[model samples]
Target: METVKEFAGMAAGTLFFILLTWALTSSYLEEYDLTSAKPATASVAAKVGTKSLLRPPAFFVKIRQDDGSPSEELHRISRSQMEKLSIGDPVSGYATGPTGFSTIRTIVYDSIFYMIGIFIFGFISLCCLFATILSIPAIDQAEQRSSHKRAVKKKRERRKKKKKPKRTRSGWGLALGCVAFFLLVTLPFLSNLVHSALPAGKNSAEALIINEDSYVTYRKHEDSSYRFNIVFDDEDGETILAIKDVTPNTYRNYSIGDSLPIEYQTSNPYNIHVRGTTLTDIQQMLLTWEMFLYAALFAVSGFVIWAYVNSRKNGRRDSRKGDRFASR
Candidate 1:
């Protein structure tokens, strides 16, 4: 009972460390939180010809669409400013109203995370090192009992060989399993990136919302999780959609009967994204967060497997050492 308790304690400790470390470094940003779609003003800055001679000369030029019409409002040009501004030009973007987020990469949040990661990583590494150190004496005892260990290992191999008759995966089964696992793990993010990399039909297809669901505000809880269904008349009959995620706009509101654009692939009519939309910084952050979480889960599962294997090895060694000392 004491030995069982000790074993459980060790397991709990290892799990605690692994989970705590992962939580610190994991990114959980939501893509819907990062979208901005308000009409913004764009004005090109007058190009300041090559500011510094030493540095790779950079220039900024202002751009503004001038309509001689009396009702035009002047706006600053930015990447998210929803204006036509050329790259490497003096284009600054500001939210016309109070809708744009930090627009600064959420550096403050990153700094807090940086500190948290450092603290957790340092703590867990230290704990692992301590465990390794404590095992040195046990390792010495194990070295003295190598022969009994060989006998036990042989018996384990016999058992495993016999047990293999119960479960078997053929070559094709293994290959298919691996393929399914990979697709399940990676397709969503790849598809999201594909929305940009793969060209949509140059000729826009007809799209209308069959079920917009309910209105969701994108800005609160700092998460932008919006779900809706869009149905469109496709080559394959009238196709209906339950859009898993549509990145939210600045308003953070998508209600019934609101028209959101969608672009579909010409070759594969099903591929689509909201029209006039690129992955916003927030959406990118959310995607990155997802990858981070998956990676953390993978790492933790790998570590647990490794630790299980190591513990089994250690137990065998300990049992051998006990038997050898008892013999002496």
Candidate 2:
């Protein structure tokens, strides 16, 4: 049983620490929401609004005309366009046939989801914090019971005309000090909680290239997975390309610079088109931080349980040894 005075003091002190920590963390959360993986604020510089380069299904060459000839005009002639368009063909309007999601919608939806997640995580933090705080009283109670038992032993020793005992548990000062120490240990862990998301876009000035290099890559390298940079526009700008084997012997490739097939965003640009396939999944920094934090939490919890069990065992062992020596 805890003295009312001690219990009230401890309870008040613990709540104070929790509120202080929550305030500091909330401020930092706001900052994180502003800067990192923000869909609304983050955007690619260029956009692939209405135009996409059509790669030829077959080799297509231009018809040559010398003077005022309709056939001799300079035009981008892909194999698909050749059946309908002749030389000097002036194609009008956006390429509509590509099927995919819109960047603007994805960005908006992602931002909303992010806001929801932050709110939910804040609640979870409170729950974990409550668990930590509640553990304090149980820790205090265990110490107190051990102290009371030691007192009984001392009284019995005095009856036997033995020397007075020095001390066992430190005192109430130690108990109060432990509340502070718990704060010192667990407060910093709040930093590990995190959330992040990325958006890629086409006008995003990224590179997509397929040539002899890719052909040689598949032929030379065996089936070990790899992450490497590939040249986008003119080999000067390099964006990350993910190469994965979706099928048994076929490689799926992705350039990080482009958005999904269709759609536009007013605020964000870096939104990339994502498919059901895991071909383009890339790890973000926030996720790694969260992983480390959770790992640390587990480690500390294990240590706490270990310390409690070890302390009880040692207390019992010392009591038995003291009794043996007194008998002698």
Candidate 3:
């Protein structure tokens, strides 16, 4: 029964590793193909809009073939572009084989960053799969030998005085810390990095300013801070309720009903910036502090993973040595 259970566990682990490797490899290859493909011109056959309470709004342009028939390929576009596009409008983008079409403007930055991540993750998964397969037999043999020794020791232990085993530190603290760091620090910073790297024009539109207001925040020691808010709407007719923290000069320059160009993420409309003023510009203005912060985060995460793995190996070695000494 024990042998069967051990085999089952090993089989499950092997299967999981295989699936992980395949998934990562597939994602990396797909992104690579998309990045390398040449741009093609396709005419828009129809405009498609999708939105659900659970998912963000997405816009697509169905491609029309040379024969004036609609093809299965759909080119994703920004909401602002979708609103202005008409049937038979020429669209230039890369065809992702059967997946559909993608504009270079949309995937260029994403391909650079995401492809690197996918490649690294895929390589690690492949290594882990091979390691697991190679180590399973040896692990089983060691477990069997250890079990026999443990059985013999149990017999001797029954005849001797029972002694308390020393408790080892649990890994729960390290595990929790990693989890918290990933959630609070890693995810947010990575998201901001991606958003900041997004280029203007491709993911942005000119929004009409519908209203403007200003407020003062009274502080204890610091001088009162003034915040200017602007309300605008995109071409899609979706209203952006508030744009906060505009400079006093900027606030005074723009009036109600004026056009205020803004850039926004295609995935989330709420993530927006004024046309000339962006997160990227801010990072540059601050001497690329955001980039340094990202580097620091990456270094910290790598160190933590290395430390955890090393500590586990050391703990196992120490435990094995203690067991051997106890047996004698």
Which is the leading candidate under TM-score? 3
Residue lDDT tens for model 1, 46-150: 322111101111222334334422212223222233223343333434332353423222223335655567587768756865664444555545755655878
The lDDT ranking, best first, is 3, 1, 2
lDDT of each structure? 0.47, 0.38, 0.59
Instruction: Give the C-alpha miss distance for residue 187 in model 2, angstroms.
Output: 19
- Stretches off by above 4 angstroms in model 2 are 1-287
Task: For each candidate, give its TM-score against the true structure.
Answer: 0.31, 0.21, 0.33
**All predictions: root-mean-square deviation over Cα?**
20.6, 21.0, 15.4
What candidate 1 gets wrong by more than 4 Å, as runs, is 1-184, 200-203, 213-224, 235-237, 250-254, 278-288, 291-328
Name the lDDT value of residue 65 in candidate 1. 39
* Decreasing TM-score order of the candidates: 3, 1, 2
Estimate candidate 2's alpha-carbon lDDT, on a 0 to 1 scale.
0.38
lDDT of 3: 0.59
lDDT of 3 by residue, 6-67 (tens): 66666676677567657765776675674557767778887654321112345666778767
